[model samples]
Target: MTDSRATQADIAACVFDELKAIVANLPDVTGCAYERAPTDAQDLPCITMQTLDGAPVERRYLDGGRVANYRFALLLRKQDQEDQDRLDARALLERVASSLAEAHVELGASRAAWGMTLDTLPHRAEAGAGFADWRTELTLKYQTNR
Candidate 1:
């Protein structure tokens, strides 16, 4: 069994790649990019994932195999009219949620020892300045062999 903990960057990379793969099949999100941060240079729709927190939830063995609760945040950014952006963001987020319903597990080297699952109801936020901004978060739980 692996003895190392999965780092935040590792989780982010796995999620980013998985999200990008799913988004690629989305009809309306043809040009969107899966990014780690807002690239400001592009006004196109983009998605980002980040690790918020992690904690051991259960111990399965004496050697550090355990279930861990990892909170991950997904943010969607786009440029559009106030009302339109809100609706667009909602649609995009819904699509994303649907794609992730089965949950992404293992994710190459960032394997979740017991797979992954959505741990909480999604939370959403919206804002408008020159353009509208909308975001949502989903907490995911995965077993880790620390």
Candidate 2:
């Protein structure tokens, strides 16, 4: 019989794809870029995903696997009025959190080989002169056996 276990990359890809799908469907999100930093040319109200670092989880069994982390940033254009920008950013931040919660349910139900948690960092309007960015990190723990 073929092995049904998952690898680190497989779990990472699954998480990324699921998150991308969820975020892309959110209101006002123009684009979702995978594994890349946002650039000036990217459409505003966009999200970017990049794979960060990972480490093996300490376990009593040799068949245990590693945990991978990914960084996700939501970018929006800063309006001329400060309050408007802040409100817009805050709404988007809430939407992102809600999306992550939905993703948790979706990912958990669909992928039986892995588990994920999301940690949202502070929101910042300092992503440059004209952009507000909200950042979050996703941690995924999955088996690496074959």
Candidate 3:
């Protein structure tokens, strides 16, 4: 018998939940949610996840499956000392990357059929006086049976 196929939403939710669980134990992570960044400064160092785009892998006569790209935004407040905030952001980024790498290996071994790839974008500080909004974009590529 063939394995049951999961819907795109199911796959997305699974990935998001896994990410949430991974980051929940990290230091300075104030919040995690599906879409919509937090408005309160207290919620700084928050992570917002969303499914950006997806498409099927092209192939003839075979179930090539679909690939979905998910985006995770890490937001943090700038400190009084610019260097300190930058350091904190970078530290957090490193931790996130490490966690994702480990998760990818574990998931790959256990799931076998599904696949995941993580692309970490450069961190940037948003404009606006007194607001040190350092943001990092993590692109997660997920594949599942079509």
Using lDDT, give the best candidate's number: 1
Best by TM-score: 1
Tell me the TM-score of each prediction against the true structure: 0.70, 0.65, 0.65
What would the per-residue lDDT of candidate 2 be over residues 1-146, giving only the tens digit for each residue?
A: 01223433455566667767877678677677766545564476666665565443433244433332333344344322487767777677666655654565233322343455556543664556566665555555443321
Name model 2 segments beyond 4 Å from true.
1-6, 63-81, 104-114
- Residues 1-146 of candidate 1 have per-residue lDDT tens digits of 35334454565566666777777787665344443545463554666665665454545658765555545666666666667656767778666855765555454543463544544433345544444445555554556554
Give the root-mean-square deviation of each candidate in angstroms.
3.6, 4.8, 4.8
Backbone clash count, each prediction separately: 0, 0, 0
Better of 1 and 2 by TM-score: 1
lDDT of 3 by residue, 1-146 (tens): 01323443554566667768877887678777676656666676666665554342322225644444444455544332577777777677656655754575222322232334445543655644544555555555544443
Q: Rate the local accuracy (lDDT) of all candidates.
A: 0.57, 0.53, 0.54
- Relative to the unseen true structure, what is the Cα RMSD of model 1? 3.6
lDDT at residue 86 of model 1 (Cα atoms): 63
Span of ten consecutive residues with least summed lDDT in model 3:
105-114
Backbone clashes in model 3, listed as residue pairs: none
Tell me which residue pairs clash in candidate 1.
none
Per-residue lDDT of 24 in model 1: 77
TM-score of 2: 0.65
